[model samples]
Target chain A: MRLELVKRPQHSALFSAVSPFIALALTMIAGAIMFSLLGKNPLDALYYYFIDPLRETWSLHELAVKAAPLILIAVGLSVCFLSNNWNIGAEGQFIAGAIAGGILPVVFPHVQNVMVLPLMLVMGIAGGAAYAAVPALLKARFNTNEILTSLMLVYVAQLFLDWLVRGPWRDPGGMNFPETRDFHPYAVLPELMPSAGRANWGIVFALVAALILWFVLRRTLKGFEIRVLGQSPRAGRFAGFSASRMVMVSFLISGGLAGLAGISEVAGTIGQLQPSISPGYGFTAIIVAFLGRLNPLGIVAAGFVLALSYLGGEAAQISIGLSDKAARAFQGMLLFFVLGCDTLIHYRIRLAHSAPSKRTDVPQPSEPAEVA
Target chain B: MLESILITIATAATPLLIAAIGELVVERSGVLNLGVEGMMVMGAVTGFGVTVTTGSPWLGVLAAVLVGAAFSLLFGFLTLTLVTNQVATGLALTLLGLGVSGMIGEAFIGMPGIKLGSIAIPILSDLPYVGRFLFRQDPLFYVSILLVAGVAWFLFYTRAGLTLRSVGDNHDSAHALGISVIAVRYGAVAFGGACAGLAGAYLSLVYTPQWIENMTAGRGWIALALVVFASWRPWRVLAGAYLFGAVSIGQLHAQAIGVSVPSQFLSALPYLATIAVLVLISRNRRLTMVNTPACLGRPFVPAR
Candidate 1:
């Protein structure tokens, strides 16, 4: 059997709205089959993987904690992607942000005040943006492929972080652990509701960022510029929009957000800089951005869904002896479905057992229209 | 000692050469598959698992190749048939490959690996340093060299190769002339997948001979860089691969020498080198513009 696609006269609004949900449903079905193949009862695994994590108050807090970074990083990514600037190096920027933000508490341990937290947050945004600018500058100046350059920077960032914690930032008084000194109370991000769980102001920041970006992307001229440039560079050029300038704008926005996520994760969740601060949140945010359909508001919801998967992975591991790695696989499959389902918005698919019949009775798409 | 080091460098270079050559062909046919890392890791895990289970290194290599090609079909289906954004779809493939490979390789971790032995050509193996480097290397090293030459010939000399290149340069024209653009792309993608799988197998079966999670590391991405560095030429890819191999192996040797520089700094050299090479190559705009496949990464739907 061969798959054939027929172009629709216009983009399907129904599919545009419904594709994500269809993708999610398809992912769940695939997950169920995978669970059964692993010798677990499909229904039980499904519940544990999806529903059980949301059952309790503390787990809900955990979800908030996990969702914070994904949402924060993804909203930024939404801008970069919308502008057609692929910055896959947000993972590195996250690390750069963590290191930059931690410099305050790690190096200037005596300067504990109300100002330190805000200062650290600013430093983080600066650090992430600076790290991301390497690729952006290279692309703007030399027309380098941002995807490969950004990705290579991820490894460099990882190594840089490793060197920092193990070399310069190693806690001198601590037992030689590869981590920085714990943040003083003033430096730590305050918890939202201490009695419930460890969730902090990070979630609030994430929501605000998403809300603000949603407005900019929808209600502002800059948003229109990003959309126009991304959809058609030639048209953007004709409209006097500089693609290079847009690259810098989108990259800086995304990188700053990713950095904020990084510092927040460090100061709020871990309380210090360490050898590793994320569980692949930067890379995972790429999936989140796509799953969210490149809209900041959509990213907030998508972020929670991805967060649930991380929680579900841990839950399944403890309860059913499934590998936590399965969660990553599940997320990967979700992105595949998301991309595949998106095809429906522009084309209708037909499964043909033989060559597509060119029956004279069937109406055909008129001329090729001189596609460029 | 120098001979041994050279051999190690060759070992390191082989997989990158093989994978980059395949990708060069795929790009020549006008598809940019960013899933090489994903497909390569899947290959590594499958190869190690099969070799460990069957105790036949050859069979392991074969399984990795097939699995890699099969995994790539997912990418091919989404990007080619479904006409999804190629960049996004490629990233999806990488994510899925990493996730699925990690799950599949979980069982194979910590198990002893069976290393594939080098083939010794009679009499030629007896020569001093050059013989072992050239004749007594593992089977895939020779395959890597042959692949570069074969791909070079196929891409530049063959009628099918011209057709593939034409499709990459102008798919609409190819379609106008009744060439099956999608079919050619699918074939190129599968070939790239098979090469990536073989490269992954080389990692597990010969290089380290173990099933380590994310073992391919960033070599797959490096291979992608190599394709650009080579300007889509197969032989240049060989040169680029060997250069990277030296940088990587030089770092290892530096660490062994107990150089004052930190190990992590040394470990980061290859990635840094890739960035440097990319900057240098791309700085020459004419070089890139003249060689780049015109239709690379663009989604094509034949309008009837």
Candidate 2:
């Protein structure tokens, strides 16, 4: 008789990849029930969300438009996660970037040079990287909890940006609305193939960023250092790779990319800075980074998938009776289920009877089980 | 104006203090419980539900503690039984709690809060300068302070407390000493859950008295950080909680004072100060490591 509890075989290669897929399938099934309860047709509701809008050219561009920030943020976050640094303030960095970049155009409305837009882009990224540096510095110097510090800063950044639009940056002529002056034409991201619709330069930046990150993560010495650091800080120190330095580098990179995404979204799509800009893309990027397994190439795909949820959520809000918050719940459910399924990846479950009498009632396994 | 601000600070700090001290126990037992926000929100919802259903506010508080503990079991299962990463599981628990509570509390929106009357002491509460400070409070405020003191003593002075500290320092050694590691953690985590629930219930029944989505906001996260600021000491946690509460409520007061500072800058006060404090205290790596629970947030599976 086997001494230890025997696990049923589920660690086959098929189940490894199939687990995330199964989790996704379960999420959809659960969501259908939620929709039906909310008085929406499950089939048509699902079709309207995942298909109808995506069939058009304009909607395709809209997908890219929304996915740009998600992709950029997730890609940068992947690097930070790999380096074992938890930078939870990317949302704040994105807002900071928007404020910094958006401010440039409002302040320099008169300047229409060949490089004005490029200068603003730099300013945007720099702003994000600087804001990110605060948490990194604290983590590196004092061993403070980066997770809390970074997350808390999100509120501060949101308030800071909100203050700006409501105060010094408010468009004096805009009839008491809480928004800034319209970004100058030059500062706005030029549409790629104007006929393709909302497809702006942000998508290009996202793709390029993904490519570079994928290459760096797969090929470079620094990438290896980051991997080592995340896996074992003890080993990293033994290998002489400074965990503190990696913290600073990863935070800056992630924050900078998120910032670029912010500036692009505001100037490119919204055209003016408002009190509310992002729909929690920075926070959602955490899901993307994990979903993609912290791989840059995988992040590109996860970004699109998450973007669909956001777009679909909006669609459901209009089509179904679901409130804005219910849609958010749906998205959170997807994340929860996905994380739950990942549990089986490392550990296999087993069932065994403590009492010997139970073994006589049930047939034993045909052979010793081969799990993980 | 000063009295009003002081009252607000006291009121604000009560919840933060309660939540922080609860988290402090969880961390002291070497379990980093980040599901505070979720637990608090659920407590707020259930507490409000119970208060509205029954006329007594005390029942609402009890309801919160139960709900918080129940919600915490979700976190406990993932981190303990499944042995997943505590931080990731904590985040998941928060998101799940938010979704579930928001869903359940949707119907309770706009119901009036059952307000609790202040319990005035004979001479102290009626005193000119010190009455409000010493005697005028909802019973929960004083209970929370007692909790802090009780928790501090339990952690530092008791045999069970000694066992908890030993378990936190090294699970293997504690197990060697025959102090069931998982059992102690389960007890501490449950206790933390109860505390978090009480804090959340306090928000719904005592302070705001209305059900809202994500009303706890980031106070839970602030409480977690305050644990670090307090450096694992219960008394220090009390001080940290009030400090954060002061800055948070103080911002509104500062804005109300007609301070010329932009409302945004004033709003940023609490968060900015928290980050600054984190930077200041955490910069000393040695101090951070020494006081930080050695096995905090790591799952312990009995490796037979």
Best by TM-score: 1
TM-score attained by chain A of model 1: 0.95
Residue-by-residue lDDT tens digits, candidate 2, A36-61: 88777888777766776688888888
What TM-score does candidate 2 get on C-alpha atoms? 0.91
For all candidates, the clash counts are 0, 3
Q: For residues A1-372, what per-residue lDDT tens digits would candidate 1 score against the true structure?
A: 988887777889999889999999999999999989989998888899899999999999999999999999999999988888899999999999998998999999999889999999999999999999999999999988899999999999999999988899899987999988889998899999999998999999999999999999999999999988888788888999999999899999999998999999999999988888999999899999999999999999999999999999999999999999999999999999999999899888888777765633332422211111
- Tens-digit lDDT track for model 1 on B63-138? 9999999988889999888888778888888899899999999999898899999899999988997888889999
Give me the iRMSD of candidate 2, please: 9.2
Question: Model 1 reaches what TM-score against the true structure?
Answer: 0.98
Model 2 agreement with the true structure over B144-240: per-residue lDDT tens digits = 8999999989989999999998887777688778787877887888888899899898888778888988898788887887888888889988888
List chain B TM-scores, each candidate: 0.99, 0.96
> Best-fitting candidate, measured by DockQ?
1
The list of candidate 1 runs beyond 4 A from truth reads A357-372
Candidate 1 Cα lDDT to native: 0.91
Candidate whose lDDT is highest: 1
